[model samples]
Target: MLSFESAGRGILCNDAETRPSIWCKGVQPALPLWLASHPDCTPYDPASADEARAILRSALQALYVDHQAGFYYLATHDDTCVDTGPLHRADAQGAIKGMYRLRFTPEVSTVSTASTNGNRKTPPQIRLCGAGKALQRVLHAARLLSQDWGIAAEVWSCPSYTRLAREGRAAARWNMLHPQSRPRRPHIARCLGDSTAPVIAVTGYAQHIAEQIAPFAPGRFVALGATPQRGTAYADFPGAPWITLIALKALVDEGALSAQTLEAALRTYALT
Candidate 1:
């Protein structure tokens, strides 16, 4: 029951490669691969917000003892914007793209960010190109999920309701991408083909070297940074928990699971 298929792509909020948990069976540990170390080194293509909070306050002061030994550091941009319950001063990436001088201070702690739009649960936005305002901006940032956290930051995003742009994926499943073409399907691997999860083919594996698949992050790995070996491309892995309380269940903190806490934990696990 240990079906392993390594070959990675799509899932970048600052991908650092982390795969395990029998191979990410339900993926959502605040989409982690590793991001807790920084003195300053930004990488969020077309970035801003005081250069992303001085590289996330030096990546949370080098994890200041893993955040007082509590362990919680999530920072995703996926497209910088603001609105916690009603635009906290609608800081459109610095009052509409002045490019950095960010704000989201409650004293910042951490949660998760950017991941929701296999069919909308929020965090889908990428509009501001032509500026008519419909919202859309998940082009990848939060140093791609605090890639090597260095902190002094304040940003957690999820934009896009038009023209779809959840930017990339850390986890997605809904009939495997479940696209019926709404505003041209919100690219979660282009809404898969037809899936119930448990489908594999993966062309052949290793797009050069990146195949650090992290389904549970036991030994965590995913460098999936090269693809195009020729046809047969298919990947939707996450199923290998023969039992053990469904395998000790871990990895689920995408910033406190919004989408109303993952729909009330799937309506209370569908009433158990």
Candidate 2:
């Protein structure tokens, strides 16, 4: 097992003549693909300190108990300060087995019913998936969605988008080859099989990082990231406000919310 940690606080030592400089960027967008390019390499990124500890324990099990012969790459960042509580204790035992799966955050309700808007019928709920520091923003956005728009939002912590995409591709190939056999469902499909709600996946890296799972995501899927859109200023990451706006736009497109509601959100966020 090969483990690596990056502060995601891009820093460099220029020379003896100059002070150490900061690059102010993270490699998350490219690191996944770089690691995936190698044979037998499995990449995992934890959103919080507890998740990291759980992943470390799982890695040890994979190495010793399972006698796994492949390369395990555990990539972590030091830029964010996450709670070290036992939030993931219940899921630790199955961490290794479901390394590629998305876990529901504590904020998500176990209830299946969607919240209605005023006297109108309930609108379609939306799912938000994010990893690393971006997960924090997604959680905040989830709260705002319910509080401000009466939109039911579920938050999921995705530890490995690369793993999910890889498994999804493998399932596609297998199903193509065995047309008469029961089709194998990918991790993404199994995780989101029941919900037809729109999925808005956010990442601190480039948009492409989250777009990786778009093809496999059920129903409507939107990917958000650090990259700036045309005519918009560049940002290192997308925050809760931006995420909320995007969700409103998706709701408008689905006819769950009126165009006026989306326009009001855009104005509130100063996105227009």
Best by TM-score: 2
Candidate 1 positional error at 204, Å: 24
Clash count for each candidate, listed in order shown: 51, 0
Q: Candidate 1, which segments miss by more than 4 Å at Cα?
A: 1-51, 58-62, 65-67, 70-272
Tens-digit per-residue lDDT, 196-224, candidate 2: 78889987666776788888877789998
lDDT computed for candidate 2: 0.65
TM-score of every candidate relative to the true structure: 0.17, 0.76
> lDDT per residue, candidate 1, 36-151, as tens digits?
12112112221334334433443355445344222222223344433323323334432221122223332212332333333322321111111101011211222222321111
In model 1, which range of ten residues has the least summed lDDT? 126-135
Model 1 scores a C-alpha lDDT of 0.24
User: How many Å off is the CA of 125 in candidate 2?
Assistant: 0.7
Residue 135, candidate 2: how far off, in angstroms?
Answer: 0.3
Error of 1 at 181 (Å): 46
